[model samples]
Target: MLRHQMTIVSETLMPADTAPSAAAVRSRVTVPLRFPDGYTATAEVLTFHGLADGKEHLLLALGAWEQALLDPEKLDPALPDAGPLVRLHSECLTGDVFGSQRCDCGPQLREAVEKISATGGFLLYLRQEGRGIGLYSKLDAYALQDTGLDTYEANVALGHGEDERDYTAAAQMLGALGATTVRLLTNNPDKAAQLTALGIGVTEQVPTEVHLSPANHAYLAAKRDHTAHTLDLAQPAVPSHDEMLARVDALIPRLRERAEETERIRRIPESTMEDLREAGVFRVLSPKAVGGFGMGVETYVEVVRRLGRGCPSTAWTVGHLIEHVWMLARWPRKVQDEVFADGAEPLAAATGAPVGQATKVPGGYSISGRWTFASGVMHSEWVLLAVQHGDVRLQCLVPISDVELLDVWHTAGLRGTGSNDVRAEELFVPAYRTLDWALLGAADNPGSRIHPDPIIHTPMATLLNLVAPAAALGAAEHAVEMFRERVLVRRVKNTLEDRQADSPLAQARFSHAYGLVATARLQWEEAIRVVTASYQRRPMTMTDHERAAYRLSLGLSGTASAEAVRVIMAGSGGSAHRLSNPLQRIQRDVDVLLNHPTLTLDPILEQAGRGLLGLGITVPSF
Candidate 1:
């Protein structure tokens, strides 16, 4: 169906036909509105200037669908749309207004236009250059970019906040446009909270993810690490915790039994996947308006952690399902109706590593090529795949019917995950199924439209870490249980005249390891508490966000596991290294998880250091 159907005639630029009122301005600007059936009204440009930072700043405004969609420019309650599609965009003088390629401002702006143009949306373009620190400072940082400084460092060396953008002007602009609520499109969380503080309820966050390039790869990491942008290049699309656990509870025994079969076939049995469907695990994260559970992140995280107790692969798979659903939740209702009207589950898996292209077409784009490491393909009814569209990389969701799953999930660990290759030839994905890669990570992600919690707005990749720690914590707990029991009855050969538990060394090791695991558990709980606290508050501060990200990186990422391992190994003794021991598996799994890009020690240390010392930390090589 077509969206907004208003003609933006050039004459709309005429003044409001009234004398200057203290509260109103005779602004002149051209705007474009889209209609259903893929038709668009003639485009017109309107010049609207408003007070920003006590100075008049010019704004080129475009008006789209005003019914049922939140228009950020409108503030009157009576004229408000049923729901607002809010987008908080930072002013990019170099790219947005001027088409510069040094960054993704132009591409993001174009993508935002097309998306909002499709539906009724309010794009609040705040005049904060270079992520809020003006353009001159950005350029100055660029000049010093090669001298052992990341994007954040370069900005700091130039004497500027890592990010200095504010949103008061955006709120005022929304009020004037009769937009009361919004579905924000951004990766920056601070922007979302700021708009909410102004009484403009941000219903969702539309993500705008950008393509990775040699020029901006490191720059992107700075956004994720220092600025708290939420792109997870490692696992492009995955499920949330709630979805994963529900699937696991229903599929546990089946999966456990199927493990032997999985080993033989090197893939999860199709029947096991079917078992998950009957369980409703896949739909919990769907948009509530669409009849899905619409559970919050806290519930979802707990569910995944509980499942992690039995199997890490299962927990991981469940997380992937929920995150993918989180992405699907951001689609317009019309789109949502088409995808989930049947109330059937949509199983999706993604490979974070990008490799392929999606060529734009009339109604949508024709996506093709092979993508590897798709973990849940054996079970998925749909797949959200990452593809490159020219220099711009995008995420496209496709029905499983459109693609073929290749059996190639052989690995030393997580062997039963069935993470194989996904091959598709010219799969037609409607426009609604596609999302801009960079924008999705931005602070004001559109998915927050239905799920308003900022925790839901947290980066998709950062959420993936929850699974690793959940599994590690579970395994660690299990190992502790085993060690305690073994030492109670098992006698040390010639070295000790009594059971292992009677030895002072054994007692000391147990005490220490138990303390470490307990501490790690507390850390995980503390992190979850912090995140949940922000959810109740709705709008979090920059300091709160920084602390939350740090908690994830420092505590849950690897620090917790590192401490747990020391205790576990010390208490278990040399015999724990045997292949038959679960201790060996727990240690190996934790070790492998530590190598994850987000959880590694170097970046975590850097981030903690910067948070403590007022500096910036860049993502390090894993």
Candidate 2:
């Protein structure tokens, strides 16, 4: 014997000081509500009277199809056995209708509807925009918020309470629907407490996840700290780069395990290479038109540096591979299409020194000679070899099938790179595959005309000089990590109460090493910023002085990185010098990278000094 009659909750409990006079009330009518997220629910719109200012406000009883099956003739008995989910949402047109980033109201509303639609629930859509101060007043409060006033203070400045919202109508609407108990969904505990005071049973208070962004961090923080909202404000929004870097960081441990194996095999492990490929490492510098990230030099350097922190050999190989893609973009449009046709991203190995000979032919050039230090030759499909073609220095692209790999990468450091010699004996290269080396530094190139990204227009020498140093920077950072982990705990052999990290001598050494690494990073970043700025200006051009300055920075960065590792090694004990320790390997790798002809300080300094002294430009490396 269930009753269909609606209950009349205590209206006498209304605040005696500010209770409104009773007015006419209207019956609810069922209507359909739909959302862009493909959720639909039936809503019963109820208009209430006796609100303040003689204004009418609406309440909505939202439910899914299963909830609609409840018999209206026996509403009480047909009510859900468990209390329904409920949300007392104040209307925020700015956040709800427009995706404003100032607050989390919009995301909360959307989340509430989605949850309610899935389970049986009610949404008391109260028309109390700006917490009852109205829309116009809320905008005024926003101006105060911009002037250093918090949300609550801004509301108080507008002559309103921190919160002026009343839940009496919400209680009455739930009584009309025969909902005695509800699971409240809200971050504010006050909402649940208010409902309980109105005789509605709040079974559970479910805290909503706060939506945080850079724009609303302060607002959310104030609410969490000052207003007692249950929110985890400690977590900052993760940047886009962090997602990529996290993947790289996770692989560092595994890379360390395979470091010795990689060097012994004279190549990266197949599994490690697969991991890098799956993580989209090689595609970072690929043109966007061909499904590449088309990222700038800053990101390029950062990625290489992070990878180097794992294994310098792998990082060195990856750096060159990515740089080769940038080089290919300077080739003719047909070559770019052929290389990236059908969304193909081919790994390429490149060497800038014009060490090969090329003879002119009918539609291309007959190339011959050996290009040394072709890193990652085993993994690359194409080889970009610099050749002397008559009077012009040309970068000729040939398929790996046309070139033979010679295992000659046996070096003191970066041995895992397998930077073997690539020999091409009389290979015919199409004219479209050859680009003048000088054109890469100029504003307009064949690929630049078709691929409009400014990254393609970057100076070739500036980009080339960055790869080796970036790997060195990563190795330097690894050295720091190793030193901190080992030196902090190692006890001095002969001295009592003395740890390596505690010794004044060791401290001075560590500080000096850290300073050098920090200076190198700053110098590298400044050079990259300058290059990026030039690329922004169409037809990217750099004066001889600017070019020489960049070259000087590159050399200095390498020197600093190598010197930092050396300094750290000097402080590291005999244990660190063991063949099994990574510090020794890092030292060897950095030394080898620093001694590179292009990265050497003297040649770069000479070029820069001549430019500064207004001497005739003899060096073309800049």
Candidate 3:
């Protein structure tokens, strides 16, 4: 059972000029506090004015019993007169109200409230958002933190102190609340010392439990190391996939820097490739038994999306190479052993078009043809060539030594992919090196029997086709970001408006484009989730309708991305057409990407319509 009663005794609004002093009492209200955890207490909510920022603030004095109106002249006889628990919690709208995982503020606040409810104490909810920098500036600091700055550093970058909060208002509130001596609930010793200096006796300091989480682990660590907060920094939690994404995100700057060089040379720069390899970009989709991460398809796509945000070309190449590892796992055990023998990732490039001729032999097939648009061939050790042996289509794995590279990729966009032609002249691939296209499509491959991982049994066509649109989504998102930055400061050359950001048209365009991009991303993610979920189920199977719908959703995502880029380019003005402008390049890349056979919107929609109508699928593989 809980017992509490709350009522407002008075309400008043003071003018800025007539605001009460920091120690001046304004009004008092009784607040019946009840937590979800069933802890209940009655608190006298005192309002004060003329704080550090000259704003009204609040202090809640809670007790196990009801207290009289707050007065500085006398202490509540029912409340403890000596030591009492105190919490000086700053206000955090994001963490407290909205439950943002970016910080431990909400959890700390709740913990403080719960403790104060169980034991008699005060919880001074300071009106300091973002460490006394205010709400908007705090949000600005968050943007800086996203760019690889620690919380304190971000505040410093925004021209604020590491600790901008002053304890004067809190001390005054405590004095008025009749808290002469206190047992502070805080991790910072400075808080206790400051309160003690302000004439309050800190008899004891109770350390708050560290609310450790992936989002705020680094933040907590920063407080422990730099701010001298008492936190055990040792034995940090294991990194999650989100942390892996953060690691990839940290490499975006380098990838962006090398984008032009990659395009100029029609290949990913050696340094950039090495960095990506070291980052485990190529091993994301590989089997764990063979020293691979064996991440789910959704996570793999997300990684590719992040990489694409930095450089779509690099993202495309990396996605293919990583996905090829998954495909290789569908081959025979002998082939898997040979491919992963050294435990080093063998970068592989693949082409799905069965343009090559394969002559059936006793042990294998003799393949001869030129495969066009083979991305990442420049750096790959092996090439998965799609060849036709009689009436059956086969994916034959051949070493780079068996193929001749032709520098034939000349494109307006994605030029960095180095998707050139590879010619194989009578290259004899052993039986173990080839996988039947039908078996792979049905998720019934030789490798699935040996390696019991359900992901190995995923439908290959849908998995491979999904990567291109993921890269396109990244590029589209980048275009939106570029446009947002440009429009904020850019102005109409002769117009009265000072900035494009102030223009209604610019605002509408940005909003529409952002909506399109966000919707596209959601569509892509949901599609990947469905596929990965199916893979997790043993003996994964996809109906014709399911397969067609997946392809259709991917195509829609690609088209949506292209539409978003188009909208941004249209609103960006003439400067966006320049070669140096990334918008134009992104636009071109999306255009070329949408033209991909699997990602083509019209055909995919038609196939989906056919599948839904119970007709034959135009593209049976997908």
**For this target, which candidate reaches the highest lDDT against the unseen true structure?**
3
Once fitted onto the true fold, the runs of candidate 2 whose alpha carbons sit more than 4 angstroms away are 1-242, 342-344, 352-354
* Alpha-carbon TM-score of each model against the true structure: 0.53, 0.61, 0.61
Q: Taking the tens digit of each residue's C-alpha lDDT, what string does model 2 give over 1-622?
A: 1113333222343333433333334666989877655667677677765544445567666665224324322333544444777889999999988868798898898888777666667777888899888999999999999999998899999899988888777776665555666778888888888778766777778888778654677788788877788998653332356666777787888788888888889889998987886566776767766666677777778888888888899889988888887777777778887777533247888875438999999999999998888887878888899899778898888889888888888899999999989888888998878888788556677767777666877767667778788889888988987888776888978766557888878888888988999988877777777777776775677677777767777778889999999999888878878879889999989998988875888878888888767784586766
lDDT of 3 by residue, 495-550 (tens): 77899989888899999999999989988976786687677766677677777677
User: Candidate 3: misplaced stretches above 4 Å?
Assistant: 1-239
Lowest-scoring 10 consecutive residues by lDDT in candidate 1?
1-10
- Which residue pairs in model 2 clash with each other? none
Off by over 4 Å in 1: 1-280, 425-427, 439-462, 538-557, 562-581, 617-622
Per residue, candidate 1 scores C-alpha lDDT tens digits across 136-199 of 8888888887676888788778888766666666665555554555667787777778767655
For each candidate in the order shown, give its overall lDDT on alpha carbons: 0.61, 0.77, 0.79
